[model samples]
Target: MAQNVTRAGKSRTDFRDAIQPFLAPSLREKCATVLAGSVPGLEEIRIRCGRPLMAIGGNGDFFITPQGTISQSPAQAYLPDREDLDRSLQLLGQGSAYALEEQLRSGYITLPGGHRVGLCGKTLVESGRVMRLINISGLNYRLARAIKGLADPITRYIVVGGKPAHTLIVSPPRAGKTTLLRDLVRQFSVGIAELGFPGVKVGLVDERSEVAACYGGVPQMDVGFRTDVLDSCPKAEGILMLIRSMSPQVIATDELGGRKDIEAVEELISAGASLFTTAHGSDPEDLRGRPGLAALMEWKVFERYIFLGRSLGIGTVEKLTDRNLGSLINDKFVLRPRPGSGD
Candidate 1:
């Protein structure tokens, strides 16, 4: 998984700069120094009220000390008070809470660089609905790293007969399904002329801003030149909209299932668009047990199923099967170096 270890086109400063705006002056300076000296695997930066500032990476979680060094022991960590959290939220919102109310209600805010800040706060309820997130207590900064060639291993199976396959990627959260899905879109959109694959139109439904990581109607990540993205749109609605309007040859989305999503998938497939989507599951049985998924399997909605796990770090290929449950790739032969497995 050396590919996963390196950021490819991105720099360490890019990740640090993305999250810098959300930090208080003192903490930002401290973290900037730590980030400058840190390795490339920093995946997340965590901030909490009255708690120590922490950063997590492929190596493991480490606290950012006051002296701007990575410390295994929390004793040397930089602790921020409640006032810092307030200031951080102010910086995050940019003095316009009303403008970000919708994202706040969703418990996350997408920064310009596609970095997502997950909010933990008291829920303000109104008529059985969460109207707002108030009294923000903690924030989790999930850095977005787009690796260009992450889909190289699976491209052979997905691109069959000179067209994108109806593929369904399965993985638990943070297992890199979204990253893989994004790269697949990029590969399909850009195409490999030398490999005999021509670039095709790809319609992307980025419901949670995870795939395209769009900011202000523009994609922060490279989703390929021919990809059309509908950002922050519901999966079901966006799929139908893309099929009807964009007339995409390949329709891609992330984390799909349920009656509406399944129904929409059927409609898109029937409209002659190949489907590429991901779901949360560890194995085929998990996919079978998931409500509404059995119907999809019965219909053979997905022609290729790619299962991902963390055994070999993010985007590890655990299994690849066809519609009939026949193995397409030998799972044992797909091994990559797992995390913490020394080079």
Candidate 2:
């Protein structure tokens, strides 16, 4: 916390100016984590209040300092220079935002789950082509991870013959579904012989670095030695690409929607790759009732759907539903439970 050199009085304004929308105390800890190169499971940096902890690392090597000190490298700080912006623009022009993102991640960068940075700029499209973007502004450095046992909450519900079923995890906003998915990836990745499946070959479609955070063609997170991730590719294209090349036993992704993505899900399942995904919804009905997910429900694309929520400020397993079982929660229509069919 003392890392903030600014004092009270006029220094408060300077602190506000320098600080990136978070308190100095938390920033110091985040800064330290970023410098460390690898942040452990489920860490993230967000904008305003809410999650207490803020954003984190990308799938690239983090530097605390661009220029090395007599004892260490320079600490990570925001880069708003036009020279850096120029480089970003040039790289982006070639549809190489991933490369540009890697360049910006030189030092003191945050990396939770080995996740990479989220960049923003003006769109550069021409005649149905997304050429690149210009005027880079605002950076969202993400932490990547493969936290073992993150799926423990639903560990009891997901197993089918000792292996987690073809599962769909659902949550709203930031209820930790991706975080939970990240955990499942780790669990599946474990090189276990007795887990029924020996050395599961897992494929992670991390278009947004949700699992297997990758930076510059290298994985920043340990998503299991058996895992292969397609970072930054469109979800549908990435799925097709994985099936074509990776020969995966399981395919994992975050935030599913769109006809193309659903089609890919169907295609993969047809080939025998179990699909795991998350979407922004609170319950199974909320997901099933949605126009997009309704088709998947009709096709029974997912064997299980895990609903997540925060209970008393801690993440909780709110519900789990199957096509036959209907609502796993005691009360589906209301938050409080009522007399149920389970007796």
Candidate 3:
């Protein structure tokens, strides 16, 4: 029998160790205090100059008070000042903002543990191009996490006849599409022992630096021992490059919607490399409405379509269908808990 895989414990240790060190001392203390208690399903930490410190979690968005308590009233929350933002920026840049010029121009920095700090500020435009960001105003710290075995239930549908099927994961924003895709990459690269599949060479094009979350060319998240990542590279170019150079058995990338991206997907298909990718949509009609994606659907490019949503909490596999969009299962699939989880 295939043993049921349980959801991993939600711990804030990764966030505390990886992200807190870069926060301003005072702000760090407040965050640490809030995290010292039960985990809040924390997803994002938003800090804006002269604004209350805000955190977004599974439950919803809430403000963080100076005493490290969650507050519904923003008026009572701790307000970060100019100095706090300045000091935090310096720490994030390691005392040198100029050193992160390229990342700043791109408006985000990938931290050590795959955590990304998004920057929004005044821009220095030269010839209609943003040279760099200046007078930083806000920062959104998106915590990166890996839920091992999260893809266990869907792996069987993904792999058929000893090979990965061309699959497209559909989900709205924050609906766990990226998280699910990340786990899928890890499983395919490491191989699913329960399904008698061996690990294969997997190429990952991290266009947004999210899937693999590479920092300084090293993947902080576990994508599997056999995965090769192309960090911060465009999907179209990176896909073709991986096919010619790495000869990956499967090529995974995030968000496919552009004309060039579709063309590249064609190349990947022609080359006989399996594909694992995601798109921002709730259903098949949403995909058919898009010009680029509509063509692929007409051609039946993907063999399996997995729809995800938050109806049963994040990472919920709402539905699974075959190429023809016919239901593959009669009922909503629920993740089984491991023995003694007490759920």
Candidate 4:
């Protein structure tokens, strides 16, 4: 099984183990060898029918050769056959694709260890809605690793005056927004005792099963000691439900967009619950162009706006700003690491 240590210093899981079951036999063997060998910073393992097998790590993307070494040329990589796709579907479905039709329609499946396999294929549409993906062509097994205590540097800003601020984390895709958000959730769940912040009830709306990465109704990740998660639920609906029933001091979710989402955020704020969520963007000005986000900014829904990017590393804090769009901190700020935050 996967083994990961939580931000609260608890053991959880590893991505390679979680991804093993979904890989075809030959590819699985290759990946196992790669993992067993020293492939520093290995992250994603890619499989495509007509293309070479690829592996992505901290250095960059490269093709995986038959000898388990990084291929300098794509031509040196192995091309997975059609049977590999069939086997992958069956394994990912745990025997039958019919069992996971709903998740397939969403273009991805959330595996047990919070690992996600994104699929690409011809879209089957019925009555203007996606039915499923047929003739599957490609799969990207994106690795999910939680860097425990990554959020410690920003805890002081989040927990202000013994209460969590309405925070909105902004970043472009793959900028570690989700990872940062997850760590923040864990910190909120356990609270920073050194900072005089007590653990409060946090309701997490994991719309894509990405936040808490719950498997079979239980979180594979440690969000905190006091966190209630609504997995794979619609953002707007989940937000309302969490507020009505969970009595959370803070409501956290991922990828906020759409009118209903904005309405839900307003409702939660009205109900006296602090909000924590993320959006896709480059910087603060990028948010102004997006309609739903622009509305949130206009309403001043969030008290703090944190901008994350890949400046120094994946989870680098690019900028920190207030609700009024005033700058607060930059990447060079001297942030002391907290206990258990892996200084």
lDDT, candidates in the order shown = 0.82, 0.56, 0.85, 0.80
Each candidate's TM vs. the true structure?
A: 0.92, 0.63, 0.92, 0.93
Model 4 residue 324 distance off true place after TM-score fit, in angstroms: 1.5
Q: Give the per-residue lDDT digits (tens) of candidate 1, residues 68-170.
A: 7788988888887888788888898897999889988889888887888899989999999999999899988888877777777668788777778899998
lDDT of 2 by residue, 1-343 (tens): 0111111111223322323232233244444434332332223433222112233322212333222211122234332344443443343334454654433333122232243445555666669765654455544443332334445445555557765578888777656677678667766777433345455788899877556656456765556778888876788999999999999988998988888898898889887888888888876667777666788887777778777776533246677787553666563221111122001
Global fold similarity of model 4 (TM-score): 0.93
Clashes of each: 0, 27, 0, 6
Candidate 1: worst 10 consecutive residues by lDDT? 334-343
Tens-digit lDDT track of model 4 for 40-152: 55667789997898887766778888776777699999888899888987898888878888788888887876778899889989999999999889998876766667777
TM-score of 1: 0.92
The pairs that clash in candidate 4 are: 2-13, 2-14, 3-13, 3-14, 4-12, 4-13
Q: Which stretches of candidate 4 lie over 4 Å from their true place?
A: 1-13, 333-339
Give lDDT: candidate 4, residue 238: 98
The residue ranges of model 3 lying beyond 4 angstroms of the native Cα positions read 1-10, 37-39, 126-128, 334-343
Candidate 1 wrong stretches, greater than 4 Å: 1-7, 37-40, 332-343
> Model 2: runs farther than 4 Å from truth?
1-115, 128-130, 191-197, 325-343
Best by lDDT: 3
